[model samples]
Target: MRAMAYETYGGTEVLRETRLPLPKVAPGEVLVKVRCAGVNPVDWKIMAGGLDSLMDVVHPVVPSWDVSGTVERLGIDVPEFAVGDEVMAYARKDYVHGGTCAEYVSVPVRALAAKPASLNWAQAAGLPLAGLTAYQLLTRLGTTADDTVLVHGAAGGVGSLGVQLARAQGARVIGTASPRNHDRLRGFGCEPVTYGDGLTERVRALAPDGVTVVADFVGGVLDTTLAVLAEGGRHASIADHTVLGAGGQWMWVRPDSEDLSTLGRLADQGRLTVDVAAMFPLSELAAAFTLSQEGHASGKIVIEV
Candidate 1:
């Protein structure tokens, strides 16, 4: 199989196309023929050793966790999927080897979900990690019809989905993004506010009673979050752990087939959609990673295998 792998923890220059043997499918796992892969900041950050202390990495590590593909074969004890099933998975394992950047990936059945019928390969690939993060966090916060939600980084991959998910629950959504993206956010029922200076004040102007939940997708907004939350309001961050010390949850997205599958259902219903900013070929994974590392793409960056 052909895969772009990094020999060491370093820059995009470290990634190179290489040939490797097929990944061994373990019990309860399925071997997928990769059709598309989603690239997130964590993909390149891990390549640069950002997660070295947290996860053990093997030599020549493959770099994507988000996969959309077809099942080629099923592993022993795996009964939930069949050959030729179209699926998408947040394929993070007990460790980070056998990623989706390769021609084939072995994903655990527990991480598998049927792809959203309305989405094409690149769009489906873009949904797993970001959509899961948004869905899980909003669920944890207990957002409801009566609540008003404020989302930091509203135009971002996760934040964009968060806005839709919150609005689906009948919550009034307020999101922070550049002025350019404000209109995009508004298209999906979010009231968009510009980020940076006076964010709390801007949010307050929209929700005078204070927000019922604050979701931080961008770091360095703890002050704004704290300032805007109403009494008994909940808060969480995927970007900042400091929120934990301030009575907010620090969430890391998990691979739950149930949650991923629900996201697919939402997409199929037209209540949710993926926003893809760019697509790269498998050979140009380095360029894809470079774009993600730069932190400026508002939508998901996908790799077409």
Candidate 2:
């Protein structure tokens, strides 16, 4: 199997396309033939040794953690899935067998869910990590139908889905994005506020009563979000939490098949939309990582294997 990997963590240049042995299916695991792999900020972060402290406590690693693929083989103990099942998964980041950057990946059955039939592999590939993050954060914040929730970075992978999901639950949604994406966010049923100077004031002018929950994907204005929250209101973030203050919890999403299944249903019903900004062949993964890191994407970038 051909995989892009680095023996030592450094930068994208350290990533090389090389032939490696195919991973063996373990108990309770399935081997998937990769169709499309999602590129995330964490992938590049690991590549650059950003998690060196955590890695030192664990193992130096291969990067990617999310994949949309078909099962080619199943382990003896994996009864939930069979060969040829199209699935999407958020693989455990600590796997020694490497990640979905390769032609094949082995993941636990609990981490896999049936892919939405309406979506292509590239679109399905983009959902797991970002979708799971959004799902977990919104649910953790106890978002309700009557709640008016504000989402920062509302045009981003996680933020985009967060806005749609919050609206689907009958919440009044407010999102922060650049002027160009105001229409897109509006299409998602959110009132879009342009992010920059006086962003909080702009949002306040739109919703004078105050927001019930703040899901901050960008950590740019944690203080401002806190200021705009109604009393007893919750705040959650998937990115930085250092400035989150003492009021609400910082959220780190854990992969769950249950959450993935829920997202799959939303996709299947056409209630959720995945905007894929670009697609690259697996061989061009380095360039894909570069594009994703540049932070100008309107949607998720995928690597087709």
Per-candidate RMSD, Å? 0.7, 1.5
Cα lDDT tens digits, model 2, 186-271, are: 99999999998898799899889889999989776787887789888888777766645757778877879999999999989888
Q: How much is 267 displaced in model 2, in angstroms?
A: 0.9
* Candidate 2 residue runs with Cα over 4 Å from true position: 56-61, 95-97
Error of 1 at 264 (Å): 0.5
Query: What C-alpha lDDT do the candidate models reach, one value each?
Result: 0.93, 0.87
Candidate 1 wrong stretches, greater than 4 Å: none
Give the CA lDDT, 0 to 100, for residue 289 in model 1: 83
Clashing residue pairs in candidate 1 are none
lDDT of 2: 0.87
lDDT for model 1: 0.93
